[model samples]
Target: MSFSKSFLVGIGTGLLFGSGVTILCIRLQRVAREMDSLSNAIAELATQMSVLAEHLSTLRGFKQRKKRNEFYSASSGDEDEIFEDANLSFISSDSDISKGSKNRSTEDKILDTHVLFNKVEKLFEGDEKNQEEAFRLLSRSAPQHSADCGFHWRMSKACYLVSKIEKSRDNPAKAKDFLQQSVDHASSSLKLDEKCSSAHRWYAISLGSYGEHLGSQEKIKNGFLIKDHIQRSIDLKPNDPFNHHMMGRWAYSVYMLSWMERKLAATLIAAPPEAKIEDALESFLIADRLRPTIWKENLLYIAKCNIELKRLDEVAKWLEAADAVPVQTKDEEEAQKEIDQLLPKYQTS
Candidate 1:
């Protein structure tokens, strides 16, 4: 081989290596830029998460306040001291304030409470006719507040009152109408303060109950929307067990309704092979954990699931628990009776 040829070959090899190194460096720099972008994205997400956590904490504190009657007391001082009593002033005439602007002085707010308390007292302690009159007056008088009353607190209060009235009504259909109105009011309340977590929670629950009511009447798709609203509620406040309970209830209904849908479909097309029964069982189990026996709907679902699974002992236990808790309405009573009739058959087996 000639000397010139060998020298040229070595030079070519060196140039090729340099080119490769330059390309590799460019690739590494591109990768580094991508890493930086990802880091920025992660940082932004972290900030959003922090904000969400703060909001959720505030919501939880509000929900806890309701149990203590914090809203009922005239003193805005020390929330703990205000709600130490289980029952609040809103339940009584003397304690409730008439509709008014929020700019009212503290003294005026207290006076309003005093008047409301008297009215509520007269309503409850008074005759049935007086009670009806009082309810009308109180309903007419409920405040349209100036400031944002957290969505859940305001709506839940309305729901509680409306549900009570519905429970006393002679007609199941009328009771359902009352709950629907509560849901409507709550939905409207959310417009007052969209961030109110409790509003979303109660609204979701009202919708769920409405779905169940519709289901009992053979209204199928209406219940599906209830499930969707509950899912949104969970998204809004992921930590709230109350909303989760509603989700569980919806899931159970969906599973059962799926079967009904399938049966209906079978009449038209070939029935799909039996759906995995385990799917329904898993949904009920999830609901059982989220709410246990906190709501009648929850207990009823768990009992139904146990019955389907042939867990006779669990069914008995659930029925006992249901009875132990106060049944909310005549419909609830009738439902309980039906379940009671089913229990003995399971026990014998």
Candidate 2:
């Protein structure tokens, strides 16, 4: 071959080999980028899977054998659950209220106060018959006229005393009527001075009793107004834990009714889309925080919320906590037991 032809062939062969090497390098770079993108996507998927797994752990202990219909049927007659507290202690004792009078001789004031205190003590400690006897004595002996003392103050004292007696009687009907009377007298006292928190408290209690009455009659439509009365009570006495507890109860009742209704209807029409489950969860959470140990209703709502949100794991956690806490009374215990029995069934269904 000639020298020029040999040089041209050599140069062409070198260029072809160099071009192939460059193309191979470009292919390798593109493959590395694709691999990096896939790795990032896999990491994100793993994080989401971890979150989902944690959520599922909460529901892991829940049994899946029970049916939803069985749970609902068992919970249908939840009437006794409504009256969880019939034995809560009233706020004040007679001794707390009856300090000795200045005008009456010290000896006389002491004597009167002791006797009244003893009567009240007996009223609270006694059964139905003894309570009635104490009530009669209080009606007869309570100073008919604290004339030199303020009339409004005396009226409040009288009303408060009667309320204690009636509450101690333990007869719902009589207790309610007496509470209404107390409310009227308290209102009269407040009309004389509108800023009296005591009067407002008394009125709120009366309103609560009225709400209970409506509930007892199955007037759920009317009973919806209980929230207003309870809210007013909270506003009037923000310092009192009792009123706050009542407010919690009020909110719980609303949340429960919403839940029950939602379950029956298959969806929430009253609550917004995001709010359907979230609203119930929010209310129950507030109630749970405000009064943790005593709020079985709060826990119940939380369980149901977790169920609706499909966070079975959370439901199990809350149910465990609920199961550990004593239910406070026989009725509460029974109700909780029923709920416990229903949990697995409902979850499976």
Best lDDT among the predictions, by candidate number: 1
Error of 1 at 50 (Å): 37
lDDT per residue as tens, model 1, 214-263: 53433444454555566666566665545555555555555565656767
Each candidate's clash count: 18, 4
User: In model 1, where is the ten-residue run with the lowest total lDDT?
Assistant: 70-79
Off by over 4 Å in 2: 1-202, 208-225, 239-241, 255-291, 294-311, 327-349
- Give the clashing pairs for model 2: 58-313, 59-312, 59-313, 66-345
| Sequence-dependent TM-score of model 1 | 0.48
Q: Which stretches of candidate 1 lie over 4 Å from their true place?
A: 1-138, 146-180, 205-224, 235-241, 258-297, 320-335
Instruction: List CA RMSD, all candidates.
Output: 24.3, 31.4
